[model samples]
Target: MADLDPTATFKEFDADGDGYITREEFTAAMKARGEEVTPAELDSIFRVADGRDGDADGRISQAEFLVAWDR
Candidate 1:
């Protein structure tokens, strides 16, 4: 899985490689995975994966991706 891209987690979760993953996607990849999450969970998940510190920093780097996923 070294070729993995975590921020692209949604894309990977999309499975069929469609350009978009719908609420059903969120329901499956995130919620059904035991997140107890909802389709309306939050866009922040993406930003979080993108490595935004939300304190006016920049895009999340690859190292951040590893650390975040490691969580």
Candidate 2:
């Protein structure tokens, strides 16, 4: 099994514990990781992982992010 728990990652990224990661929270999380994503890059990445079903709005859910990143 993968070592990471995507649910946990999601929780961490969600920040406000609101069950969703807003764009601001997402950017903050990346910055916390010492990553500086340009606006264009962030938008592109978000669009890719927003989920095919749109159940997550435009945010990447923990499970979805983990599976997508693991590849």
Candidate 3:
């Protein structure tokens, strides 16, 4: 996982190739990997990831994702 390129990985989750990753996109991406993630789990994750700025727009930008990934 650490070896994976962040930009490419982020793009994968972006799904629609949007500049940001929405909850739906993230969940879909996780499912594609055969991981079953619940809404609560996703909520917890976004809470932490988006908490970085205290203003989460319900979408994750590449820069925000990188910060979360490093942690």
Best by the TM-score measure: 3
- Indicate the TM-score of model 1: 0.39
5-52: candidate 2 lDDT, tens digit per residue: 767777878998877666788899878877787899878767777754
Report the number of clashing residue pairs per model.
1, 0, 0
- List lDDT for all candidates, in order: 0.51, 0.73, 0.84
lDDT of 3 by residue, 42-69 (tens): 8988887678767777788888899878
Which segments of model 2 are wrong by more than 4 Å?
A: 1-4
Q: Which pairs clash inside model 1?
A: 51-60
Candidate 1 yields a Cα-based lDDT of: 0.51
| Structural similarity to truth (TM-score) of each candidate | 0.39, 0.69, 0.87
Query: After superposition, which runs of candidate 1 have C-alpha atoms over 4 Å from their true positions?
Result: 1-4, 39-71
Query: Residue 14 lDDT in model 2?
Result: 90
Q: What are the C-alpha RMSDs, in order, of all predicted structures? A: 6.8, 3.4, 1.5
Query: Which residue segments of model 3 deviate by more than 4 Å?
Result: 1-3
**Candidate with the greatest lDDT versus the true structure:** 3
Q: Arrange candidates, best TM-score first.
A: 3, 2, 1
